[model samples]
Target: MSGDFYSERPLFGGAISSTFPLRFQDVSDIRQVPDHQEVFVDPARDESLIFELLDLKHDVGDNGSATWFLQDLATEQDAEGCTAISKGRQGREAQNLLTVYLANLRLKAVGTDVLIVAHEPILINPLSESATAVGAGLAVPAAQSGCMAMGEVFKLAVSSFKVNDWSLFGA
Candidate 1:
């Protein structure tokens, strides 16, 4: 996917940073929210990345833990394959732990509280006729294929996430 020509446009000033393909469009205002920070779309692939900040203390149910929060979100999307990836502080703040998860969704919402959130999606296409018939590419293999390259690209994007400031919650 990412060759030598990719570029990253930082988001949220010096507070948080990550990279997305330069072709993506910043559509933050489309779903304007007081906390709905940013949204980027890769038009060619129908994929997207969205970032948000949420108030777990005030968000509906006392469903305060990341697990509960994701569960609540799952209600709206009916997504499958939800996997909790990480949970802990996003910075040095003690106000709330940042959470991360992965899911396959037709529609979905994910958040962190007192949380900083990001949603990155990769569109899945059916495997080639030969591979689909043989059921290969289901798990990663030594051979380099379009799917493998795409996975590496997304892995880099997810791994690139970092919190640069804690002021959103406290000092």
Candidate 2:
């Protein structure tokens, strides 16, 4: 994480931008998917970034709350030890915050009912306040594992993800 550098890479019609090591390929064009807004891959780092949109009308076979939507997703992956984040005295969390995924999880939620989802495999080190999925449930050097150093980069991409065009999700 020391001495490494990063630059901005915008995606999804410039609605969001993220910092990568300036080496990862921005496959946003050639690797296009029907519902995916953006995709970036860094094979050297064995890492990937995927930004997807879920149209409530088209994607959900049944009308369910965002929590149920996310729960179904977790169940598909057989994700173990799934837990919701602690709530405040009001029994609610930050606006739109629905879930904190496993191993340095994400704050998943419905972005304007469009359900913009950002998925990443990263482990968070609470003491250091960084994230990445590598070395999760194990002790190892980050540099050797290659995931520890990507904590900041992952955070940047995720925190910046936004739905610039609300219409895309329908009015």
Candidate 3:
């Protein structure tokens, strides 16, 4: 594998702010599509939407909001969407929502991943190191891909803040 990940588009783009990752035994519930209007806004901007993890560790908290940044690729065929069904009773909303938006673009998670779970948004302080680090780190990938993979970029942002085995509903 190449040390430097090659991409025709940016990996930080095309990532949407999803409700949460639905747990399932199979991946059949996921599919690929082109219409991101339901999951994203603008669909052109490759900016990071700040999100706070709820009481749980990983993922956006129960009452959290994250920006869905994405870019639908035209080339390449391998595309993956989010889970169509929710397994637990906790997942009543965001059912069948596409979590991964892949199209001719591949993004790799590096060692820069970090998790910050709290009851409130800690990103409000612009001068804080956490905000700066997250902003700068995300900006690098955003700039690297030239904002090509908007969807992937948003996903990375989620991945960056998501904690291990952390549930949004605290289940």
Candidate 4:
């Protein structure tokens, strides 16, 4: 359909970074760096954030992609206590909190690529794991079709089974 064709174009293509908020900065004391320190000061990046990996959006635009907004759900103190507080009074509190954060990210990403990255374990508990297993946009494609669709037809095209009518759009 038109939706799939629009999603497969490359007029708005780009990749999303892993984490948005927790980026690396200059470390005054190099020795203070932990062995598992995820933050690394990259001179090339300057103030930009770094991520483990990114999801490639092939057809949105010329090399368009979306980086995920990652946050560390780990804590130095008692995780059980925090989890209890998150689920004790209100069962939906924790999910709601995360959803609000993601919604804010989505809003901030109105003009650019936005992705939310969180570990499976941290995002869901054992008993309630299946709830978030499918994820927010699992059934939907990762392409950003909003801006691309608004452009002229020259910027969007779709692949087809036959070559007789190259103007056709699909698959």
Off by over 4 Å in 2: 1-3, 56-71, 77-142, 145-148, 162-171
For residues 1-171, write the lDDT of model 2, one tens digit per residue: 644456776666666455556545667556555554465655444344555554334343333554665676555544444432211122212111123321211223333333333333333223211123232222332356544344555566555555454454343
TM-score of 4: 0.16
lDDT, candidate 1, at 133: 28
**Model 1 local distance difference test score:** 0.41
Tens digits of per-residue lDDT, candidate 4, 1-171, equal 233232221111122212222123324335353321223332212111111222233344432232122122213211343332132243443331121111112212123222322211124333332334433212221124322121122122111111232122121
lDDT of 4: 0.24
For model 2, give the 10-residue run with minimal summed lDDT. Answer: 87-96
For candidate 3, lDDT tens digit of each residue in 1-171? 212232222111323232221110111124332231222222122122223211222343322322211221111111224122221232323222223332111111221212211111112223323333333122333345343344544444344432233222233
TM-scores, one per candidate: 0.47, 0.46, 0.19, 0.16
Stretches of model 1 off by over 4 angstroms after superposition: 29-34, 56-70, 78-150
Q: lDDT per model, in order?
A: 0.41, 0.43, 0.26, 0.24
Model 1 TM-score is: 0.47
RMSD of each: 12.6, 11.6, 19.1, 18.6
Error of 1 at 53 (Å): 2.5
The Cα error of candidate 3 at residue 76, in Å, is 37
Question: Pairing residues by index, what is the TM-score of model 2?
Answer: 0.46
Worst ten-residue run, lDDT, model 4? 153-162
